[model samples]
Target: MGKPKGRKVARHGGNPNAWREPKASSPSLSSVTTAEGLLEKLQSYMESCEFVVAEKFANRALERFPANSRVLEAAAECFTETGNITKARTCYLKAISVSPLKGWRKYLGLAQLLEGQNAVLQYTRGIEVMERELAEVAGPAQVETPNVPSASSSTEKDTAEIPTARDISNAYLSISELYTTDLCDDDNAEEMCKYALDKAMMADPKNPEAFQQMANFFLIKGDKEAAAQYVKGGLTLWYTDHLPPEQRISPENQQKVGVDYEEGSGMPGLALQIDTAKALIECAEYDLANRLFTEFITHSPTDPELWYLNGFSYFLHGNDYYPQARSALTKAKKFATTPHGICYDIIAQCDEHLESIAKVLPPTEDSDNEEEVVQTEDSVNRPEQSNCEDSDWETDEEGCEDVEM
Candidate 1:
């Protein structure tokens, strides 16, 4: 039979394009040549958690821009994140050598890589550089009349790379933490910590980390109320102050508020936010922690660690929150099991929590009602009810006789 005029003949029984191979897309890194371009590419890879690819690209960047301080610093950051501590140290050293007195960040980076006195010395150098740089920049303004506003101050606000008081404060905060951790055995550790913390707050009263560090210090001293107050102070800087009363009431609403703040401010990155959330959790601020975790989960739904943290926060809130804890833990276990084999540890922890919840909650009314219904049906069908009654009577009589004896 002849085909109809409007009918189209099938090519390979369906589509002609089906047999064609897909074209591979070129990598964006191919176009990058300048130091800035390479840094951006390196950062994009690092942010996406592509450490292997980031390492390869970082090495390529180093080969191309061997003496570029910015490139070296950025590559060092990538290496540090990927656990190549030795290479990261080398990169930081090279970066400092290339621009010794210009940037303070490389000193801080190298300091973080070292331990004990060496780390303290590096941190001190970085702090000195920061102070000197700030004073030099502010020198011209000090020379002018006290009432006059500096032209540079207005212009500097738009520059993201310029170190500010907050940076100096954060450096001091780092020193304070080191005293509490790596240098705790020193006779002057507590005094040094307090001094550093005081410097941090004085340098930048608005710096949230200063408040957080103070909270930690107070917590170490076993002053929970003071720690909580400081934690609240930290939260006020970037979180609570930005929200309306209505939005502050619930975690979901608070998460929305956080998202809006993040979009507008762009100051607190995910890591900082996570750190703040963890601080809240540690200070027994479960509501705030849960809200922050909700926002984090919205941004990175596949992050099992966040899910686990959320669950743990609820668990610590007490038995009343067990249901929410179970749900979050289950989600955490599910995500931890994917693309990799099931995480037996997560499974075990989740099972343990579930057992705890089971122990706390009474048996469901439905089960009890079902049992009663089944028993009633069995009694109706069985003609041996009298025999059961007789057994009960005999047991009661035996008990009575024993009591009398």
Candidate 2:
């Protein structure tokens, strides 16, 4: 080789733990001439969370190559890690000054460090920086300089000046959340939300973030129709609409066909399905929830909590699923461990479900529901909304109102 690379020359004494050495005095600025050597040291310090050491390496690099925007960017990260946000802000500004047309990333970081009107201002500046950078990269006369690598060359995440659609979506979502959720400025928040949706649609026609934000925004404004429209726009439509009876699982007839999952049992697929089903129930997608619950119960039939939720969701869907609802509630009551009002509620629900079926069902269908009526009539004839000992309802699980109904 004509010349050796940036490897260290043999010192008088070499230690086995050279790479593992603790933070020490800064290297001489002239000694670390090449950006690669400085970057390697800085990256090592950063990976080890030695922010001060990383800053020292970056400063040394900057002293030799003042125009090295990447070194300045590295220094900014180190400053941020050391909790010196003001210094970090200065470093970012220097990075942008060094290469105005290639500093969108630094601008993005600078924006994150600000808040309120300042953050909005910074974000607006960052958008302009990114647009300018993209225009420069796409210009006809653009030239590649091999002498100095771009800051983005440090990693794939920082490689692009043109912001990805997801990136734009995230920026919009952040600003919207800041205005709507943090500041509680509904008017400005709504404007931001609309702009975000437009940006998201421009980025990708089917972006989920746009739909989710629209759904939440409309839901907050009490516009259910608009909420429903946006909810349907999302890629996942499982929670959007009602499922016909045929879509629900007949768990009683599912003859040990699937696997059962445990609560935090560490079984991967089962937990995922159960969690998905549980979320569906919360979103009032009882049809899909019922199917997931039934499938999970088939595998893990002994779970009293699952039984309870199955019964509860069916009850909410009305008397069409009354038989299954009553049966599940009765089963849940038997399996329940706590001798609390939850038991009473389940029993009461069973009674109400039976009464409802008696009205609409044929005379022969009345026998099963009426028979259950006499069995619990003497002991727990309290209505579904029990007037006695309301304290029992107070301690129940999620969605259980603490009021004495």
Strongest candidate by lDDT: 1
* Candidate 1: worst-modelled 10 consecutive residues by lDDT: 396-405
Residue pairs with clashing backbones, model 2: 260-299
- Reference-based lDDT, residue 224, model 1: 74
Candidate 1, 98-186: lDDT as tens digits: 66655688899999999877888888888887776677577945533224232222322233155788888888888888898899999
- TM-score of each predicted structure versus truth: 0.59, 0.51
| RMSD for each of the candidates | 17.6, 12.7
Those runs of model 1 whose alpha carbons end farther than 4 Å from true positions after fitting are 1-101, 141-162, 241-256, 260-264, 363-405
Off by over 4 Å in 2: 1-33, 44-67, 135-162, 236-283, 288-405
**Count of backbone clashes for each model?**
0, 1
